[model samples]
Target: MQPVVHLAVGYLCYAAYTRLHHGREPADLPALVAVFAAGLADLIDKPLDAAGVVPVGRTIGHSLLFVIPLVLLVWIVASRRDRRLLGVAFAIGYLSHVATDIPWHVFSGDFDELGFLLWPVTEMPAYTGVKPLGTVAGIEITTLWLEAVILVAAVACWWMDGRPGVGLFRPSHRA
Candidate 1:
């Protein structure tokens, strides 16, 4: 559940950041910026997670209402089209995370060890005990996995976007 949620959010954030701020072409600033924003969101998660029911790291923070309105505000204030795209994609991707993550985890396996994905209806991870660690752990399983996922997604996006001279998170290479 944590894996799916964060991975999707990270990829979406990267997509939004890359498309919106960095330009549909390529740039590193937005990727790093989104990572920073996600980190900040994680920090906010510490105080916002409410038994993962009302909302948690991937629920509210990753929610469309939260991420979209936020990006819209930035788009309005900064007049950044790229950032706006990122915001939109970020919102969609984040929500998609929940859509794919929660329901699947909730109904996937035995979930005896992890079932908070259902929330309200069923709880097995003991709330705080399964309260996601990647955002906080930084290099732990959740973070590492999400990092890889987002990296792959971003690179794939760049490739598919038809931009040239870019390898991945790195700058363009004409050589």
Candidate 2:
């Protein structure tokens, strides 16, 4: 999935989680963390792959090997800080990113593309020449439409949530 799609889906997931768990709009800090975490995989992988530090774009960052321990650590630390929701938000974002990448290959029965999930245990598949910011494999038109729908839904949901995290970027007015 594209970065924007990942971000929108992450926010949508977090927003729904907050509504279910807290019965309110997402809190600012957790929402922000979720958004950042949504892009964290690509942020880590793409740079290393582009720099030739890793053989493939999805290796460690896309692996359950990495994310499981990382999420657990985050959960432990956040629990100690009494901010477990932050950890949950991060997990939702990160896991959602990995999840979003799976369905295309699954539907097409191209399981090898998912070898990245196991990392060194399974060889990283050869690069498919699909640009990260460009078209997805196999179903470009459907993916584009899906991304558009997700973006629209995310914006509508955020608006309904009273645009919760937007305040984090603006200076607060204190009298």
The number of the candidate with the highest TM-score is: 2
What is candidate 2's lDDT per residue for 38-61, written digit by digit as tens?
889999999999999989898888
The estimated TM-scores of all candidates read 0.39, 0.89
Clashing pairs in 2: none
lDDT (tens digit, per residue) of candidate 1 on 1-175? 4443354455555565556665664344444344345444344444556555444343345344455666566556544554554444444444444344443334334354333334334443433323233344454343345445655775676567553233345666686
Q: Please give the range of 10 consecutive residues that has the lowest summed lDDT in model 1.
A: 126-135
Return the lDDT, model 2, position 66.
93
* Cα lDDT for residue 27, candidate 2: 86
